[model samples]
Target chain A: MSEEKHQHVVPYRVYVIILIALLILTFSSVGITSIELGEYTVAAALIFAVIKSFLVLTYFMHLKYDKLYIRVMVGFVFALFLVVIIITFLDYLFRT
Target chain B: MEHAHHVEHPDMYDEESSKIGMWLFIFTELLLFGGLFIVYSIYRYLNPEAFHLAGEELNRTIGTINTVILLISSMTIAMSTTALRKGHKKVAIALVVVSFVIGFAFLVNKYFEWGVKFSHGIWPGSEQMLAEMSQGEILFFGLYFVMTGLHALHIIIGMIIMLFTIRGLAIGKVTIKRPSMLDNCGLYWHLVDLIWIFLFPLFYLIH
Candidate 1:
């Protein structure tokens, strides 16, 4: 067999930890809905979701161990996504 | 980079390049769903009450179950890669199989959930939705079905890929040195879970 290139074996325990954290966040997001936060509810839920995605991307997808170029590529894509969302919101918020 | 340029072996594989290609594909997927999400946001902003009311009609318990199932499956698939790297071929295969089963379970749950909704005449373009629901509510359910349906399609595709990966593993084609195929499949599986992470909160947990 050829030598494994860029082989970075993450410990099994870390995956378990990330999984637990993700589950907890999922529950917390559900629990937060019971409270009467009004407009803040959606914001709070989305924040937790963002954090959960970050964990999945960094750990489960091995982006943390991946090269810098890949990281930059992902970051750019997300940034562009956010910009498009914000621009769309601007139209909705300002239209008479 | 160095190996690909120098080696002329027929079996030569560039795992790094393959991974980059997968990431690029994932980016396109993100943008594709990102467009849908924007449309959801606009409709929600326009008709907040209808969106919230429609969200209440969804079954939270089932949504939570499906969320947990997908998260666990994601872990199993990610760990399968580790198992493969450690040379535990059987364990790795077992983990991938577990992921596949759990993924199927998720779809089954979805089928029932959609069944309940359909029975209630809540489907898009249904006479009940058209006559009874507000414009915003109709739009909400429309996006709901379209987004989740697209996601289910992705899950099915991912499972098919996993099946092939298992076949490769069984034939000794996928080894520690040639693990890129499994790695790419794992990434795709995680992307499915990543999309669900947001979908759960957006569609089910809104109050």
Candidate 2:
């Protein structure tokens, strides 16, 4: 838990590479959604959005280089959000 | 004078705790936006057609350009951290300045985008909306304004933080030895970009 162990500086090259990947993903998301995927449009777009956020989180935000607890907390928060979404939808579905 | 060491130890800067504090605040932000996402989902579900119609009215080209702007700015800010850490003070400040410029570009694009909508009389409570738009369309535009407005607010705040960090870097307050201020600022900016990643698809692309 010492701060000395955590100064792992990310490289500039790595940030540039991640930026290219993000731009490609952004363009692909737009392109894919342009093709009429019908009901799957939202799903496809959301999946791309999720992947983009993961990259931004893991690299740009340095979660990959951070402590284990910070990672765990972030995971838990996202999981909690997913559960909330599911329950809300379920409640919506079962309504009379 | 003998107690000076203990006093300084208590005042010692700790990056780990500082980061934890930031993450905690970020979690609250997640919850705040999560609530909005939930509301959006329910509304869209209740009126899919209206959501679709209103979503189509949005300009995807501007949305895509803004997305790229934000993504590039995010990278520049992240690279600024690396530059600062590597002791390239001038490069670090330069990258941050690039971020500031693109951030302003995004804001400018948003201004015009919102301006177009207003010219079309499509704001949340405009009379044209009350007279002609369906209730679902009203809800769609309402959420659109609120969600994007809040996000733009975050962008402004992030730019302000970057301004301070830019000053810190120039003045030697934010240094390689104590870089939490700049690091935390990067985290905040990336979060804003992350939210836009989702918001772009939800409000513009997924339609």
Cα TM-score per model: 0.95, 0.96
Give me the displacement of residue A25 in model 1, in angstroms.
Answer: 0.7
Q: How far is B86's C-alpha from truth in model 1 (Å)?
A: 0.5
Proportion of the native interface contacts kept in model 2: 0.98
List clashing residue pairs in candidate 1: none
Per residue, candidate 1 scores C-alpha lDDT tens digits across A22-90 of 999999998997688999999999999999999999999999998798999999999999999999999
Task: Give model 2's DockQ, 2 decimals.
Answer: 0.92
Scanning candidate 2 chain B in windows of ten residues, the lowest lDDT window is: B1-10
- Off by more than 4 A, model 1: A1-6, B1-9
- What are the per-residue Cα lDDT tens digits for candidate 2 across A5-52? 347889889999999999999999999999999999999999999999
Clashing pairs in model 2, backbone N/Cα/C closer than 3 A: none
Number of clashing residue pairs in every model?
A: 0, 0
